[model samples]
Structures are given as C-alpha cells and as structure tokens.
Target: RPRPITPPCDLRLQSQEVQVNLGSGDGARRSMMGDSSTLLSYYHEDAKTMYEVFQRGLHITGERDGPFLGSRLPNQPYKWLSYREVSLQLAEHLGSGLLSQGCQPSPDQFIGVFAQNRPEWIISELACYTYSMVVVPLYDTLGPDAIRYIINTAEISTVICDKAQKAAVLLENVQRGDTPGLKMIILMDAFDTQLLEEAQKCSVHIRALRDPPGPDDLSIVCFTSGTTGNPKGVMLTHGNVVADFAGFLKVTDKVIFPNQDDVLISFLPLAHMFERLIEAVVICHGGRIGFFQGDIRLLPDDMKALRPTIFPVVPRLLNRMYDKVRA
Candidate 1:
C-alpha cells in the first residue's frame, strides 16, 4: 500500500502503542520504540503512495533514481546534479508556459543540440523528451554544407549549441530564410548574453498549440546518416526509450548498483545514438556529471581532472587512441 500524506502538525505527537512478547510460541513480539514506531507506521502508509508516485509519470533519466548516481569525482569537492535536476530543468524549459511564449514545443520544436559528447548534450536531449520536442543533433565534425542541410531540412526553429557549433548555426541562418520554422537560436555557454536575449525575442512558436504531448508521446526526432544524401529523422517515442532502458538494466544489472560511483568521460558526439544512450543511462542513475573543459584535443588534461570510470568512444576515436599508443 502506498503511504498517506502526513502533515507537520501530527508529526510531533505521533506514538505507537503495540507491545509483544519475544518468547511467545506464535513469534517474538516487540514494543514500539517511540520514534521508531511512528517512523515505521509513516513509511508503511507511504509504501503504496510512493509506488503510485513512481507509476504516475516517472522517467528513467529524469527521475530521482534509475541509473544516474551521485558525484563520482574521486575527491568530491563540489556538488553535481542527478537525473532529477536534468529532467526537471528540461521539463520547465520545454513546458507549455515557455513553449507557448513563442518558443516551440515538440514535433515542430526544431531545436538542434550540436556539440561533442558531454552531460549537457544528454540533458538537452532529456529536456526535449520532457516537451516532446524534435532533437536534431549535428555531428561536430560535419562540414558547413552538411550542417546547413540538417538545419534546413529539419527547419530548425531554435538551436541549443556549444561554442564550437555556434558559427555553423549562424552560417546556416545566413544561407536562407525559406525556413519558416527556423526563427530563434540559443547558446549554452552563456557567454553571449546579448545574443541569447535577442534570440528569445524572435517568438517563433512551434509547439502543438492546442494539444500538448503526454508522457508516452513521441519525445525526439533523431536523424540518421544517409548514404545517398541528407539524413532522415528517426522518430523515437517515450515508450521506445523506456523499453531500451529496461533492456540495458537487464544486461548491466550486476555493475549497475556497485559501480554507481563510476565517472564517465563523454568524448563522442552527442549526435551519435551510442553516446546518447549512455548519457540517458547516466541520467537515469542519478550520477554526478562533469563537462570536458576543452575539445578532444585536450583529452589528456581532461582525463587528469575527470578520471572517468566509463569512457565511451567511437571507432575513429579508438583508432586514434591505438595509433597514439603505438607511437
């Protein structure tokens, strides 16, 4: 049974009256230990309540617990966020209030997350999930033309970009105006406060004005690389994410809990599904997350500070590492 709501008023006076004999044939009985009894009773009443809370609209990444854990940085100096912070902030940003205030929501909320792999990328993706927004993740290494096509094809309205991809976003904006959906662009660094303020004023509303998405709604539209030409958006539903996460838990059940303190060095592009999935896992676990200060070029320095437990990589990065080792 779920627990009942307890108000502050009744907390102080709460007491237990049960007393039992330990050597009795039925079983060992016990007496209530003042605060212990009240605590047990409160928790007992809350069991069902907690379960229902979880069943309501819990997210694997955004919720308080799943996979993402507390800070894994060896000599924990500062506090880091868990999946809850990532999801809630994302929810607030992508909520109806914000989306309706001219900023678009999912399906049509063409927001591009362009950067190399990092916790922010995953948080941005989760934020998209909260509002059922379209997520267009651009490869960090793509040329200007490819970048232009992706933003144009998606008709991106807003772009959540890193310092490296800021130039590409602007270049695409300058290339054309036929993109009716493309309206505002924001930056994550907070360096360009002036630009951020200006972008916010554009009022390019794209949220499904009338009907907002539910928890089970389509959360993101990821684009896959095309052999022939432009990439195609792969529509992923909230259900799909839940299913995938469940599978992941099954396989990594053993290491999931004990290694919850593992730190992950994210070096892959946020655009890649593998990195995205791992980020999702990290969010689900309420783990401590840190961003790489510089690009992959400064990997040695970043690792010295991070010393991540889980280091995800692509074939290209692996090959480079292998080459370096040989050298």
Candidate 2:
C-alpha cells in the first residue's frame, strides 16, 4: 500500500461560502461555481458585439472626445490624440476606404495589423470592428515566414502597418508572390516615393492611414508564439473578448468604473489578450490610453509623462519593483 504524501503546506486554504443563490443575483449562474459566480456582462446594454461596445461608450458619454489616445517621441512628453477623431471619424474613413478599395464588410474579411502599441494600431482595429471585419495582428517578433503563413491562411487582403519598414516587408512579400491575397498595404506613417513605385510595380496599393459600424463574428485571429511548433491562429469571437472586459467591469462597477478621467499606459503587447482586454475595458468607458516610446529602458520617462492611472502588472513586475524599493 502507498502512504499518503503530505503537502509542503496547506496552500489550498478553506473555501469560503458565498451569499448568492443560482440565477438569483447578478453575473452568470453556473452550477459548478455556484449561483451567479460567473459574470454574464457588465455592459449597460450587455454589449454582445464589438460594434455595440464601441457605440455604448458614445451613447453613455454623449459624444465626448477629451483626449483619448496619446504618444510621444524619445524623451518627449506624450502628445494627445482626440477621441472624437480616432474613435469616430478615423474609423469611419478607414472603413469607408476599405469598402472603396473593394474589401467587403464581413466577419470573414480579415485585415492585418503589424505594429506596436500606438494610436494607429487601435484606430485600425477600431476600423475593423466598426465595419464588421476581423482583425489579424502580426507583431514584430513574428518572422517573415510566419507572417506569410498568417496572411495566406486568413486570406488577408488589406494589411495596415506602422512604419515604412513593415510596409516594405509586405511589399517584398508581394513582389515575390508570397502573399497573393494581399492587395493593399496601408502605412500608418509617411513613406518615401521609391516605396510607392515599388508597390505599384508589385501590383499592390499602398496608402497612409489619415483615415469604420457593425456586428463581428470573430474579433481577433491571435497567433501563438510557436514555441512548440508553427504558430497556430486562435479564433476568438466578439463576445469572447468583450466578456473579459465585462468581467473586469462587473468587479469594479460597484466601486469605481473607468471614466474619461481614467488613463492607461499601453506598453504591453496587444498581441496577447491581457493588454487587449485592458484596452477594451478602457475603450468601453471612453478612458485615455498612452503608448510608450517603443523602448522599455525609457518606460520611466513615459510613466512621468503620462502619469497613467492603469497598469498591466504581473507578480514578476511587482516583485522586481518590490526588490528595487527594498534595495
């Protein structure tokens, strides 16, 4: 007979009892977690789609812009991006531009976004959401081959990139016929004329976004890091992403929900769900978000500049900070 192994310590403390009954109180009522343990939604309308989440903010706030997105240069303070322009006007223009460029406004229509945490990235994402299109994000660490694989797999037609270099990468892919589905490459920043001619020769349209309304089936086709093997794309619905923010909302609604006064610093990768959920929560509340200056070593400068109200922290970061303060 085998002897029972003792635990290092009773890490699993006694489970506490709850006050609510199944389906009687708020949140989702699941039997395993007991009555209303799960959050059904915290959205005022219980926003079922990304379109509604974007619209819900406007409806609640009565169309207030009030400095939404922010960014900065090296050692410079964060500059403002108006909420009315980004959340409303730019989205509409981009969505209309996509439609004009022959891209359909459907859930199956995928748009690629290859960039860091910037206003343009979120603006492009909002454009997709507003037009009922799916967003396929390709981050920097995703190598050339993986990027090609995603573009083909998702049948991505329009790809919005941050800078000229990323647009060049897509153009090269087009030149070699690696991305046949790719037709339009939208750069978020200025590019020289040489690149435009190169794009023209490759039979691809290139434009800078100075530039979306609707229900989306899939929210994001977020790819894995391919640590084990090739990267696998995970399909998430609008409800799936919104539910995360809604869960956050349910937790804070009674105490403090984020308003226009709230500010978030988006240094974390939106490729991961953590940052995406944080952005979603803030966006639903018309809160401000500031992007770091693309360097972790200089994040303290950004911290001083923005004085962000929200931070995406893990135990590791907290531990490091604790150690630094202790030292």
Q: Which number leads on TM-score?
A: 2
Cα lDDT of model 2 by residue, 113-202, tens digit: 998888888888888888788899998788889999999988998999989998988889888989988999998889999999999998
TM-score list, all predictions: 0.61, 0.83
Candidate 1 global TM-score:
0.61
lDDT agreement with native, every candidate: 0.52, 0.79
Worst 10 residues of 1 by lDDT: 41-50
Model 1: per-residue Cα lDDT over 21-97, one tens digit each:
54664443332222232312111121122111122323433324443322223343324554455445544454444
Over the full model, what C-alpha lDDT does candidate 1 score relative to the true structure? 0.52
